[model samples]
Target: MAMFVHLTSAANAPRIRRSGIRAVGHGQGGARGVYCFPVLPSYTHTHQWLRELARFGSRGGLVAVHMRLDDTQEVLVGRYSDRARGAQSIVSASEAVRRIAALEDPRGWEVFVPRAIRPREVHRVRTAPQVAGWRYLPDAHGVRPCTCDGCRVRGGYGSRRLRERLPHPLDGPPPPVKVLLARVEAGDPGDPVALREALHWFGMRRRGPLSRLSRLAHHPDPGVREALVWAVGRWSTPGVAELLDGLAGDPDPDVREAVEVVRDPE
Candidate 1:
């Protein structure tokens, strides 16, 4: 068997011990599965996901669920960053274990099992140190992070502190929906950067009159068209759905991709 460790909220320990870990995906691409690290010989490396998982764990303290899989079981493996971008490869469980174990530094490697781990496959569930691993990424301690609107999370833990320390060019509280609407309505149609920034604010606020952004649905710039999809997709106002449906088959691949993400923002 190839051993694996899954870090999850401790509040889920009881249910996990009873029914095993359910498959769920995170990040933009929405690849649903059970994410885990192969149980390496180094104890610290084996539990490397503790801290990162805790940031998103709403149930408080976390627990490590040690599990096992048949050596030949197929699973997806890739760099932690690659998984978010939908880049990964299918390999046998033993192969994944062997590959990571051979790496002198396997800090960012991740494995995903597409199905639920059966109760029998769960070896043990134990509480994990809440601060055992890195946040953002490994060796990212002193690096200055990008504070751009797209790079920074709005309501993430410690986000306020980060914003105070490293303000972005476009950083600040979001403006009223009406103000954003005026920016879009009065802004230059040909300047994609300005148009997209206005649309980005609309998406962040997740509110606005859909008709205000209707003109950009067929914008010449792909980025502007993509921004339009994101901004309008966040609203549930009538007509918004119909407008998105129209862009569902946009000529630009990026615009079409944005439509898929907006429609299935899991």
Candidate 2:
């Protein structure tokens, strides 16, 4: 019993006048009903619709308008129009989504507003004081006493400065994959090195060589899948688009919602 109407130019003004009156009666008759009206694609058209709706005085009516914006930044507003009443303008789509998640209705509708796009300008800044000259520490052996807390704790002033040889080539233990997985999952913003390493290992190109490891991205474990989604957004790799497209159809709504966030224009 729900009805949807698309409005555009002033040329359709007469048609809206006829339809708006009918929608109120129609909505009141149905147990649960919606009257969706999408506007044509132009800012001028959208503005006109708002003006007309206000003029019609359909303030308490159940009629809703839809606004469409094109890539060129044109806005189109559509609605059922009745001279007897004006329609309420709903909240924007982004706000509506949040309200919906909170189990609340965002009863009004507004047109999409395109934000101004500007190019980023990079300016170099000095590195943090903590690691500013850290590279020189390894070669400070004998030349300077080790002031490191570790050296003091062990009661050995410069023991850490003494260079140690690498373990025998074949004697070193391989890295623990589970630990690596856990580190990636943690995704602590404080640890850029760990984040980068995890991204490299699980990413499409590098992961291609590690087929079994990459399969963990689509693992049955919710934690693993969630981490994979986060990694994909963090990395923002080219192939990630295809992966997200696939996830858009996932049976799990959470996964689909995550994918939608990355795909959204805003």
Candidate 3:
């Protein structure tokens, strides 16, 4: 889970350090382990440095490569559990090198290039609002949102199924009709009812055929007209392109915006 790198300006320090290296490990309770490296004079060659580390043994401890991704570096742990039997093929540093080098291959995950690690630092902070529109849920969903506090609360499940329904477009099947029927029936030309209906239909039978409802794109109501643009965007029907293109120049700004949203989601 942790990686440590040593850097020194001396050209021959690594070579001198590598000559008398030893593999050490813990004994019983909370004992320490140490391992030395056979370094070479100035790792001017990358492959040589990698080979030296590959040959260095770790006795029976874990071996891993610390990889760097965008803003984080990952420690990929190797699997090596046995030590007492001297099972030569069970684990080796060469295996770790092969895994680490594989990371650089295009077919494999990319390797971590060397970079400086920033020092750990701390800063003060404060809390802020967690989510948007949670306070207005009762008004939005036409039902009370959960208001139970942690203290003195009771919980129970209701077996009853609350089947609230909403209106469907005249060209299609009925949907879960809602109390907003009155508003939808009498709302202005820019009302969002038709868009809401299309969204409902889109959510319900997404796999159903669309050839029959294609005519709804020419509905007299701008809301219905705009909804058709959005529906075509959602369904991605090639036949509705002409209708959406016409609505792109609708006099109503809302309808025009809907047209644009459908035409260019970017």
Candidate 1 residue lDDT tens string, 1-266: 99999887777788888988776555326645688899887888888877766554336577888999999998898887787667888899999999999998988789988787899999999877786777668897899886666556656778778877876767555667777767777755657887888787777654567776788987789899998888878676789888989899899987887787666432
Q: Report, for every candidate in turn, its global Cα lDDT versus the true structure.
A: 0.78, 0.35, 0.34
Candidate achieving the largest TM-score: 1
In candidate 3 the C-alpha lDDT for residue 198 amounts to: 49
TM-score of each: 0.63, 0.25, 0.27
Over 4 Å off in model 1, which ranges?
26-30, 84-86, 148-158, 164-173, 177-266
Q: Write the per-residue lDDT of candidate 2 for residues 97-145, one digit (tens) a residue.
A: 3332343221233332223211111111111111111122223445643
Count clashing residue pairs in model 2.
17
Q: What's the best-to-worst order under lDDT?
A: 1, 2, 3
Cα lDDT tens digits, model 3, 1-266, are 22222211123233323331111222122122222111122222111222223222122221221211222332222211212232212123333334534443212111111222222310111121112112212133566323221111112122011111222234223343342233344434434555466444552322333454545555566667665556555454555666667777877777887766544321
Residue 77 accuracy (lDDT) in model 3: 21
Which structure is stronger by TM-score: 1 or 3? 1
Candidate no. 1 TM-score: 0.63
- Give the top-scoring candidate (lDDT): 1
Q: Candidate 1 — what's its lDDT?
A: 0.78
**Model 1 residue 42 lDDT score:** 89
User: What lDDT does candidate 2 reach at residue 40?
Assistant: 28
If both were scored by lDDT, which would come out higher, candidate 1 or candidate 3? 1
TM-score of candidate 3 relative to the true fold: 0.27
